[model samples]
Structures are given as C-alpha cells and as structure tokens.
Target chain A: MTIDASMRDALLGAVPSLRAFAISLSGNVDRADDLVQETLVRALSHIDSFQPGTNLNAWLFTILRNLFHSEYRKRRREVEDADGVYAARLSTQPEQGARLDLEDFKTALARLPPDQREVLLLVGASGFSYEEAAEICQCAVGTIKSRVNRARTRLAQLLAVESVDDLGPDDQTRAALQATG
Target chain B: MAQKRAREVAEDVVPGHVPPAPPRLDRNAQARLGEQLRAMYDDLLQQPIPDRFIDLLKDLDDIEKGKSTGKGTTG
Candidate 1:
C-alpha cells in the first residue's frame, strides 16, 4: 500500500500510544519523542511496505520498538548513566510516593528494565495481546508473558502499592491524584 | 592446611538452606496494578499531541509528493 489520507490518519492515530510506549522504554520524554518522531519518518517514507487492512498500530509499534533497540544498543552505557541518576533521584523521593500520582507511576515504571517495561506496557497498558506483543518485540510469546509478570511485580513493589487501599478510594487511581492536590 | 581441610569437611557436611522467595502479587494486587498501568497510559494517550508531530505529518505530504518510492536510511 501507499500513503493515502486514511493511512495517514491511521499513522496519526497511532502516535499517542507510540509515544507512550516510547517513554516507557526510554524513560525520558525527550528521547521518547525523538523515537516517536523517527518512527513516524520511517513509517511515512516506507508506507508502501505497510499492508492496508492489517494492524497499522502494531506495525508502527514494531517500527518504533526496532528503532529503540538499535538506538538503545549504541547508547547503552550513556543511557545507563542517565538511568543511574534517575534511579538515585527516585530513591530519595518521599514514602508517600505511592499515592497513585502519575509522576509516581512513571517513576516506578522507569525503574523497570527496558525489556520488561516494554512487554509490560505492550500487554498491560497498550492493549496488545501476548502474541501481538511477542511479534512486535520479535520474541517468543512466553517471553512476553514472563516479562510482563516480572515487570508488574517489580513495578508494584517500587510503587509500594500493597493493596486496594494503596490504589485509593473507589478504585480510582488517577482520581486519587486529583483528590490529593 | 589441616584447618582448611577441617573447614571444608564441616561445610560439605551441612545442607544448604534455601532462601525464601519474594512475595508475588495476589490477584487483587495484580488487578489494582493493571488499573494503575492503564491509568498511566490513558493519561498519556489523552494528552494533546504536540505541534511538532502535527506539523511533521503535514510536512510528510510534501515529501511524499516528491518521492515515487522511499530510499536510503533514516538520518
């Protein structure tokens, strides 16, 4: 298929999820934006390869995931240093950090290993099935499942979200954030 | 050498203790975590798409008009 109006819209529609997934992987908004931008550029230029009537969102996700890995490889050490600093900052945060704030959620998400975070976001957040996530991630489905399990376990631990009460009243986690301040 | 042999024999005779596993989330905890994950992701999804991206898509039409097919690698 080639670039058409609907296809362009499809690409646009996929951007927010792509950016969210990118942030989950890179843990920095700036780098995540750049990753999404590059994914868009590649997807637009190579629109011919995209099969119409297939899953456009998954295709875009695969593109972004691949780009992230390649770029992540080249900057692994540099990225790890930045992560060390970020982790240190998180360590010093207050105990009430588990109060269901989006910032708290993001901080906990950042602590996850990128692979684990990627699978977690793919399956848990982005609504990809295990098989779809495996395909996007180019791994076995079982790998995706295991990573999701480990990622959630680690994330919950970091957030100190022990029970439903930790999620706050009425099961409204985000609502709790609004209620707090 | 005698002390070392004695220590080795003593250690070798004792059974190793297995460490306890970390507590995994029960179903309720997992469900709540799922809610939190979706909340975080939905929050991002709901945020306004930045102008840079909107403009980039608009500019893509110009680039697409100039090309018959894509070539070369991303910059």
Candidate 2:
C-alpha cells in the first residue's frame, strides 16, 4: 500500500504524532519538527516501499529513527554529547515543583549509549514490539530485550524513579508511549 | 541530607506515584497536562516548512521522472 493519492493526507496527518514522537526521541520541538519533515520527504519519495495496510506510523518512525542515527553518526566528531549538551537542550521547562525533570530524563536517556536508548525508545516509548524494534535496529530479539531492560534500569537510576511504574503514570503520555512501546 | 536527596530523586523519577502525591490525575491537572502537550504540538505543527525541504522533494521527483524516461527511451 504505497502512499498514493488516498493515503497522502492520511499519512501526512500522522505528522503531529510523528512530530511528537520525534520530540520525544530528539528532546526538543525544533529538532523534532526537522526530523518529521525529513521523515515525510523520505517516506513520500519511497512511497512505493510503504505497504498500504501496514502500520504507517511505525514505518515512518523507522525511517525517522534511521535518519536520526545516520545524522548523529555524521556529526559524531563535530558535536559532543558531553555534560549532557544534547540532553540539556532536549529538556522541557519544568512545571513549578512539578517539573517533568526533562534534564534528568534527557541526561539519563542521552547517556543510554545509543544502542540501549534506541531500543528503549523504540520498545519502551515508541510502542514497537521487541520484534519490530529488533528489525528496525537490525539486532537480535534478545539484544533488543536486553537493551530495553538495561535502558529501563539506567533511566530508573537517572530519573531517580523507583520503578518503571513511576515513569508510566502520565495517562496521556503513557498512552502515547504505549503506541510506540 | 541523604534521606532528602533520596526522596528528591525518588520524586523526580516517579511521575505521580510517589507517597507525597497520589498518582490520580485530577481533572484540573489532566487538563493542564493536555494543554501543555497540545501547546507543544501546536507550536511544532505551526512551524513553517522549510523551503529547502520543499525544493528538495521537487528535485527528487524530477530526477526520478528523468530516470523513468531514460529507461523508456532506451527500452
């Protein structure tokens, strides 16, 4: 099911969700939007590759995730992840004392050593099954599980959350996360 | 001090499940959270699509069409 005439608006309509997912992945709105734009262009160009009835969101996410890693690799030398630059930049404003702790989350997430973060974001946040994430990340299923578990543990420590439950309480956010998780 | 740090860390990680606060999403709080997320999404969706991106797509389509023509011409 290519993104032909009927699917154009429908696919494009996934932009908000895609953008939100990108922000979750990238940490900021601007970068997330850029990622969405890139994903759209790529998806449209390779429209034939997209099956009509399959999960368009998941497919688009796979593309965006791949592009993010590629871009991250290209800028590996020039940009430093040091002292949580990427994480810090991704942090959203906290709400009074009820802040989302974006910095801590970002730092923790960023420190996840790409492989784990990739798996976690895909499996934990993005709602991709371990199988799907494995396929996307090009790793074995067990590897994806380990990465997710490890990522969860690491995030727990970073966010200082006692358990994963702590992070999953935001209903809307959780719902959003579950779609990709 | 140690306990304070631990508590703070625990609170930070736990969204609404900590002992100090119930995890229930009050309508007001839920509304606020929704507003925040919506605001963020709205801001993003409203962003001007970069001209370069638009241009890039046009170029790609043209090239693809050109390739198709070449194949037909040769065939």
The model with the greatest TM-score is 1
lDDT for every model? 0.72, 0.61
Q: After aligning candidate 2 to the native by TM-score, how far in Å is the CA of A147 from where it should be?
A: 0.4
Candidate 2 per-residue C-alpha lDDT over B1-75 given as tens digits, one digit per residue, 9 for 90 to 100:
698446545543555533343244333333333333344445545655555454655565567677777888753
Off by over 4 Å in 2: A1-5, A92-94, A100-103, A163-181, B1-75
Model 1 C-alpha lDDT per residue in residues A47-123, reported as the tens digit of each score:
88888778888899999999989997888667555655554443343455454376677678777877778887887
Query: Per-residue CA lDDT of candidate 2, range A1-181, in tens?
Result: 3333356556656665677567766666677778878888888878888776787877887898898888877877777666666676665455445445434455667666777666656655545787787677665665565455555555555555533333334666444433334
Instruction: State the local distance difference test value for candidate 2.
Output: 0.61
Please give, for residues B1-75, the per-residue lDDT of candidate 1 as tens digits. Answer: 697445434443445622122466665577666777787678678878888898888777667666745564466
- Binned by DockQ into CAPRI classes (incorrect, acceptable, medium, high), candidate 2 is incorrect
The lowest-lDDT stretch of 10 consecutive residues in candidate 2 chain A is A160-169
Q: Please report the TM-score between candidate 2 and the true structure.
A: 0.61
